[model samples]
Target: MAKIAFILLCHKDPEGIIRQAERLTAVGDCMSIHFDASAPKSEYDRIRKALDGNPNVTFARRRVRCGWGEWSLVQATLHAVEAAVSAFPGATHFYMLSGDCMAIKSAEYAHDFLDSADIDYIESFDFFGSDWIKTGIKEERLIYRHLFNERSNKRLFYGAMELQKRLGWRRKIPADLQVMIGSQWWCLRRRTIEWVLDFTRKRKDVMRFFRTTWIPDETFFQTIVRHVVPDAEIRSRTLTFLMFSDYGMPVTFYNDHYDLLLAQDFLFARKVSPEARELKRRLGVLYASEGTEFRISNEGQRLYRFVTDRGREGRRYAPRFWEAEASLGRERELLIVICKKWHVARRLAGIVRQELDLPVIEYLFDEGKTELPDLGGIQSTIEKRTRHRRALMRMLFDYHKTDRLLVCMDPRNFELLQDFCADRATTRLLEIQCRFCDDYLTGHAKRIGLAGEQAGPEAMARLLPTIRNDLRHESDRIADAGFAHLNRMRETAGPDENAVPLAAFLSIPEDKARAIAAMENLFSD
Candidate 1:
């Protein structure tokens, strides 16, 4: 059997360490854990106690304080590697493990792949060459100055630039050169591990590079390995246990995408939720029996089943209506109205104000809303709700009353509104698929008496006469479009003459005569 030395860097969550150890025991010949000294006393004791009797496990002597952009993590890792090398002298490979990482594949399979590949699996990118990095320097310098004192300030400022310059100093490799960066969580041959430790010790410049660098944990191994063995067999990508979140917080795999994970070539994944008892049970069964046909009953409902067939690709088709609805509701205030004419918007605004009893603001992009203006003649469509729209929506939602209704010219214009209203259980939404002219006609007619006397004559006339001709034109267009849509629906609808067209019920303009004819057409199709 190929001996594997598993080295884990743990801080909090002692149970997580135990779980990781248990998983590693299935594949690794030995395990060593290094606890951060700055961690709470209770956590340190718990971690020590959990791995107490494990013959393959040993606790490191030194404790280190780790921080973001700090050198401590790299120091701790290096310490653990040296300890592992001394204790497990004959181990074939050294594998880095994290407290939060969990093995997703069988230990034997993982070991065989590592052994066969004989590679490092760290990913290294030229960070200094990135455009974002260039732009960030000035801002990062300002932050460093603001956060650090005079002595520390100069050190960090010059150190950062020096690091950037050094990173920029990479030479084009010969055509035959096959340099590669490995994954941080990786299995390395003992020889490769020894080389890395030795390289770090002998290279004083490398130590200085890490001592002055931000995010040394990520940079140190990446820099040293690249410097030592340019053609090292470092795997481009591998499946390993990693927490999805920055903090490596535990979470339940409640997403539909969980099924797709089983097909991935990765051998590990992380931070499983303790509450996922059903998932645990199913996984346990599959792990023990190597049988995929494991089902779990939740509240008498057969919630999910795992099947072992190699070809069984998990396919689940269920629309997340609630999720979609909630997302829509959250986006309520981020809507913009675009129309060809200003008079049409005024008239529509009047109707919205009267019917919905809400504030309506006319917006112009150039003029910008003094109170709340519509997007300045930029065609308002669903696509407008990008980052700019999010900010605009937040402003509008914050300023406007919750019960207020927003009017947009078309369904596309109302996309943001639809999304915003989707989650609001308390807010009622009425989507009108009418053109600018039709909107004017509705608004004008609603306010004007049959005898042509206006209830609010001055306000009504301002919108009416300007919108009248356009309203007549739009009404005809809407009628034609509505009929065309209805005709298509008639061809596919079920055999029920009494079934009314959804658009017709929503007061969408359709040819009344064609609609009547289509009533019989419903069943005939």
Candidate 2:
């Protein structure tokens, strides 16, 4: 039997939460509990009490106030995922479930069922082409722009999106994203979880776009996994049965669902009301086969293999070829500017996107020093990153035509880029050997609420010279701009960044009588 960890993210239904947590832990399963910060402190304390002294349980230290249709929901989910991966790094799989979801299958059966299957189960669909929901639902959730700052501002988001649509303000999804909609809950492998976390950490454009969309929880995971995970065969079936309303809210399970839940072989069911004690007890009796053992024969193996042949192909195929082929036809000449970290990537991507009107991609080659959750290691971490990138190497390699680079030589990455981009051209690289200016201008502008805001053309014209490279072939185009202002500074105000003159240069730091002559050997004579 495979070891699986369940990530339970919930705000309400504390009774159901504690009940499920107790039941799952009673068997051999562990849990990562993230009680919504907005929930009553007593509710959280009660869950903690039930889980107290359980070595397998890991509580999310960073409690988040999760909004229903906001990115905060995704954030709370990620927090639970972070805790699970931290606690059980070698877990076979992670099943994301709500507080109401209870397993009907026995632990042995669930493990055997999962062990028999070879693919991930994600109930997904092309939102625009779905027949279950009306066309208007697609336009409302996917087409219109909905901005939300918190949970209570749902009415404001709705009204604003309506007004924007009336004003003909088109909310366009980026060309790179092939939007797919599906259930927010699904089971994924450990590798898939790590990949999703790592990919989201790098690709913030996807995150930023979804942060403003409605019910992003339903679309974000599907979109990322379908597009990025090469050749992943997503079974269009959810393990849990969820009945939804016309407005997309799940209906709570009642006693009537007993027969329906048993009719199907679904492993789990959701939205079980706290008062449905009879239904819960009946479910427990019906599936009271927890300690039972099961067996499979050669006939069963043959049938399973035949049914899952398509997924078997994925384990052998290098499916990044599909992503590469799709990327080759993209019209957007995206400039993927590499930074040493995500902060610098964001700062540089903002400047480059505005200055040249380029479709910008800011990517960090290495991660360090941030509040985001990440495992620690310098060399080993980078080595793992290199391997992960190599998995998507075809798509990454194909972007070389329009990829721009900004590299730091502070302590040098020591041929990491060469190892990563060994087959791609490196001539257009812009290496900067100076102090970073994030704290200088960007930080100040951010405090004034101009974070990632574009500078106007007139301001861009002035800033280009100060920022553009002296190593580029196009460097001459802006050469006379910044230096002229610098020369005017000499005549009007000061000498340099250090602000020391040649007369007193020796007084600052020199071994000889004059600093200019003392550094003569250091000059390009």
After best superposition, candidate 2 residue 503: deviation in angstroms? Answer: 99
lDDT of 2 by residue, 1-525 (tens): 677789899887776777777677666678898999999999999888877788778888799988777778888888898999999766787888988887666777787878886667776677677663543346667666677643578588767877988998876787887788788878877777888899889988777788878778888888877776664556766777666553556767787555445434467888787788998877665454657432211121222233344234324223244322333222321122222223443553354445444444333334432221232332134344334433333343344444432222211232333333333332223321223343444433333332224333333333333333312222232232232111100212222422243223212242221322222221111
Q: Which residue runs of candidate 1 sit more than 4 Å off their true CA positions?
A: 26-28, 49-52, 130-184, 241-260, 274-491, 494-525
What does the lDDT come to for candidate 1? 0.49
Residue-level lDDT tens digits of model 1 in 400-489: 645333533332223333333344422232222223344445453554321132223433344355445544444344344322222112
Scored by lDDT, the top model is 2
Instruction: Please report the TM-score between candidate 2 and the true structure.
Output: 0.52
TM-score of each: 0.49, 0.52
What is candidate 2's CA lDDT for residue 432? 19
Local distance difference test, per candidate? 0.49, 0.57
